[model samples]
Target: MVTSATQVLFPERIYQCEANIQLIAAHPEQGCYVVTDRTPFHPVSHIWPDHPADRGTVVLESQVHEVVDCLVGAVEQESGQLYVGADIPVKRDEPGWVFVVVHHLAESIESSVGTKATLNVDEQYQLALSRGHSGGHLSSLALNKVLHHDFWRKDASRKDELGHYDFHSYAQTESRVTEDCSTDTYRIGKTLRKRGLNAADMIAALPTIADQINQQLAAWCEAGFPVDMRREGEALTDSRYWRCDLQEGVVVEIPCGGTHVTSLAEYAALRVEFQLINEQELVMITHSQPA
Candidate 1:
């Protein structure tokens, strides 16, 4: 019988583990196999898939199988049956759910249930993602500050760490991080207006708003604030926070599980552009510079 081990490394950091290769089963139709246990590979979260999976190779003996994707797998606590990715029926951390990382192997190998294997990650790609994610967080805070004036009439309902109304939390529909940039989509529908957001006025002055956001981003980048992740514990399920020490005594902290750059100094420049997709939606595109 297979034993489930509690994860040791914090989800925000990359780790290396030597684990047994067990049950590499083909997906019947997806043309891939899922390798179980002991990986440094970070799987794309089923609950929040803002960051993509880490790509690398799984090595055993003299052969190597390229891991094209890494995804979250869950099993029933009582039944011990495994389900991959979106196939999971329950939310993560739900009572009685055991979460695992499913590494997608390119082809079948000769490894057995007890064979030891090594997992290697592409650090270059991981670092690029870290920079993009860090920049993305900062950009969102800047956008919130730039648009704070539009909600002057709302009773102070919620506030971000930077003292702006938490529009990013309520308006955001989807957020994606890429190697060089991050894209965030926000909904400005009836609910937002009901909360006293001037959607029409904001959309009309999008270019000016974008400029203000870019200015804030530039100032933060120039300040070279320290950035890092704070975790409750060194476990996959532990709560993590992305903490940033900005200028003017403003420190922004957001609950986040994704990896990020060590410092804002790594980014020489950051820029953001805005678009009005419809009467009730806005999209922000953010780009970052190299270390």
Candidate 2:
């Protein structure tokens, strides 16, 4: 009965939905974990962990439960064994695994398996994250364009959608999204040098590069380019893409699962600062404040 509704079939895509409670279990360390037949919660990805989990309230009957953390959980096809987050042994979409979003609650409830529940995400927090994520993508593209004419190996096979050398894609190590900003780090070590990037030149031009990136981002915001999210299906494992038409006459499509603002118009200003550390590590800090 907890799994009856069609919406529960792909809870991750539901965003906001009312669904039956499928299962409730006690966790040894993380408190109570609730699995609804359907939900709108965005669980922390075990693979990427970039966008952070969605925070929301789960209302059951008249009592509301605060979802402290949302996480990805998978059950084995043959054994029905459950693994959460880092405990999983295989990659996502692995054969014979059922993926589900697990909402962490502080206390266990005595509700029955088919109890109806409502999922509501905090709008303010979601909006901040959306702006941050969108700005992060924009800043990456701008960074690539700023460094396009120099420092890249002419024969570098990778290129951005706008024909610029894809420095962001090639050198990016880790990216993390915060309230109004995203920080990305890159390593310009021996491997990057071998790939035709002039690391010395990049380090020397850090300030100029930052200015160029900020200018490009400001122009993009002024143009108010359209941003769209493309979903292949409603399932958690389905492919999704963030597509944007830039003022620079380039249509960029990047595979992304996180949420984003509807357009560049939502941002008043988008700026990026660059820092070169240890003569080999490059850090790009992007900040976005919504209008």
Candidate 3:
């Protein structure tokens, strides 16, 4: 069983580190699972599972082992049982469970528990995903501002970083990030309408709405806004926030547990497009290029 929460370094921009091997075991279907005292690898969150895991390699006993995948794992306090990814039964931070970052190795290493493992993440791949994640957040905020006044009622309670109605967060159904791109789907069904999103009007003005979001994105990129991931602690289960310093002293903070570039300046340009999948489904796709 895990003695404590794994010390996570990805939240603060760490991508490589030497860590002590806590446990090593072969899974029935997932190959070998390696648990470390600490890691820089960002695992796919079992709860959200939006951003993908960091792909990299682990070096031990002078041998290089490819990390095929990284995933969130938990060890039961009483049973000492380990659960990985989709097999995890309980919610995060559930009582009597210790959370861990599980590194799936293509092959088992010669070293066992108590050995030291040097972890190295694919920097280029990580950077691309960072750009996509940051762009996704900016695009969502811009979309919120563009639709706030037109569709949402004044009584709408939720607001985004720019103080517009936070329609993105409220109606968001699914989100996924890839290399320099992100696609988010939102459902504007009865609940959203009750919250004041005029479905028919929004559909009619889709083109204009897309223009507004793109313009907002252009301005933000030109300003070279700085982005950061603020964490309450270094533990794997600790809370983290994505903060971006925008124009007019506005700071946008959204609860997040994903990696992002240190600055929007990393993006040479950013933009988003809108699509209506059906009468009640809206999809926003964001694309970014690195500077």
Candidate 2 per-residue lDDT, tens place, 102-207, comes to 8898778888777888887766777788888889999999988888888776667888888888888888889999888999999888977887888898898888
Tens-digit per-residue lDDT, 156-256, candidate 3: 88877788888888999999999999999999899888988888898899899888889988988988878888889888888999998787457789998
Instruction: For each of the candidates, give the backbone clash count.
Output: 0, 2, 0
lDDT of all the models against the reference?
0.77, 0.79, 0.87
TM-score of candidate 1 against the unseen true structure? 0.89
**Residue pairs of candidate 3 with colliding backbone atoms:** none
Q: What is the TM-score of each candidate against the true structure?
A: 0.89, 0.92, 0.95
Ranking by TM-score: 3, 2, 1
Look at candidate 2 and tell me the lDDT of residue 67. 90
Candidate 1 C-alpha lDDT tens digits along 33-148: 55555566777888889999988888788678798888777767677677888888987678777677777887766567667877788877877888888888988888778878
- Model 1 misplacement above 4 A: 5-17, 30-37, 94-96, 248-250
Q: After superposition, how far is residue 236 of candidate 1 from its true place, in Å?
A: 2.8
Among these predictions, the greatest TM-score belongs to 3
